[model samples]
Target: MIDKNRVFRVLQLAGLVGLLAACGPSFAAESDAAGDEIEVVPVRGGVYMLVGGGVNATLQIGDDGVLLVDTMQEDMAEHLLAAVRKLSDKPIRYVLNTSGNPDQVGGNPVIAAAGSTINAGNVAGAIADSTVGAAVVAHENVLTRMSVQDPPPPFEGWPTSTYFFTPTKDVFFNGEAIQLIYQPDAVTNGDSFVYFRRSDVISAGSIFDFTRYPFIDVDNGGTFAGTLESLNNLIDLTVPEDKQEGGTMVIPARGRLCDESEVVEYRDMLTIIGNYIREMIDEGRSLEQVLEARPTLAYDPRYGADSGSWTTDMFVETVYREFTANGSSEQ
Candidate 1:
């Protein structure tokens, strides 16, 4: 049976514990006002999610070294480095980012400072194109979109490695097989999720976060349907229902080891909001009207309110834009 009480307690304590204890004694420094707790925690196996008020990072420990999915903030790198050191003496070999947010890839220079190369997906392609010394790794799309931004300065770290067009990219690191699936226009353009094939665990980056509502960076290719499709694809790869709890683990960008049911709850919540927005849009409701409709009012008791930077209004806005955009596209 799922221990409901334990889950709530963890959420409560999450504001206090930070991400170090769960991973031996790695010192991951968290910023003040980042809340009392660092948002990091160990769900199952050697996979750990660095929590708090930033992007999600996944750590895979191997006899050779460690493979990190994402590292948040340049300031927090030392803490992340310390935390990893506590868990094992393994050096960080690969850093994979799911999207193009600074909070997700800001730690790149820090890793470089520590003598470890940070590998980002499409997001890092911009930096890789400009700099000669940086070891940026990513797909072609990431490379192509690097300089659409402004005075067109050279990329900081161009992709030293690239993958062809495919929904999923596979890699063998730290004695584990990791499958990275790029879901176009989800949380952000070129958003990706990491699946630990052998561990049956999914590090959902920001795609499956419980802390706040979704933020669709439209300029960067985020869409409502894309996020849903991405979630469905992930669900298909998880363990079956009967083996939850002790079975496969689903680690979000924040929070505890989520089960299939919790995932369903989140999915259903999104669906409900999507449907509500669709109905409103079909009725010729404007975006402002949809926001005022407060379709998620009933859910406020649970996923309502703000947990740090994420708020109810933000969730409503994200859903409204996505549904409206989707509605427009179908026509």
Candidate 2:
């Protein structure tokens, strides 16, 4: 009495539904007044954070003008502009991106067209520089990919400036030193962290996000080991126990301020999940078998949510891809 055809058809329909959900458009709707809304949070003395426009934007109030970090969506640009104006009359001096992901750099085009704020680091220049002249920065491998074909135009804001050199760069503003350091190839190819010495705050960008699954952009040189290494570097450099202010503050691309230890824990959780999948791969398990293993079960309560926007499966897939691609070794 088992209806095999009917059962198979039902399973097929379920599969199609899951696929559609995963591939659906990812951007959420901007606020009706997002164009005019700019929310500011005081990070410390002279530095305030303006975190609307769909992505978190940090504002460091310099003597002459304010420095901005990250812009949200293109549609939310004007709203972000409105938000910044509420903070100070000084011209916007610098707009830095912690990474190259669109959510972090997408609003660059509109924000740059509005005026001459130095979009610092990787994607910043991409947004400000002319289309033909923009540069891409990363390891030589990224350059190779760029040479074959530019990243999708929409994705390539085209960084006007590129530095494939040092792991760290420091700039002085208003008697404060802001340091930009490249991590060991985590999150994506050109992931960098912005450390504001004066505010005693660090914007680790996507490297510290808590809401969604960790996004390892393998195509852009991200790796499982690299992600953990990057987090370790941040903790060592900025979150020394004596220096931590009760809680070390971090501005995630799209969430509330997180503390230093939270980041460490996140990294450890990722490492565990990544290791579990790697073990499965080494045993010659298929991707399906790895999924069935459900290695993320232990950490699900901490990071798992119902949001299909960025789900647990996506995290598992990213780590497994990296594990297999890199020969399933320690990294």
Extract clashing residue pairs from model 2. 35-79, 38-83, 125-159, 125-160, 126-157, 126-158, 126-159, 126-160
TM-score of 1: 0.74
**lDDT of each candidate versus the true structure:** 0.61, 0.63
Off by over 4 Å in 1: 1-40, 52-55, 115-159, 241-246, 305-311, 325-331
lDDT of 2 at 293: 64
Top candidate on lDDT is 2
Q: Tens digits of per-residue lDDT for model 1 on 263-282?
A: 66577667766776776688
Residue by residue across 110-165, what tens digits does model 2's lDDT show?
55544453345333332332333222222333233334554443434444444467
- Quality of model 1 by C-alpha lDDT: 0.61
CA RMSD of all predictions: 9.6, 9.7
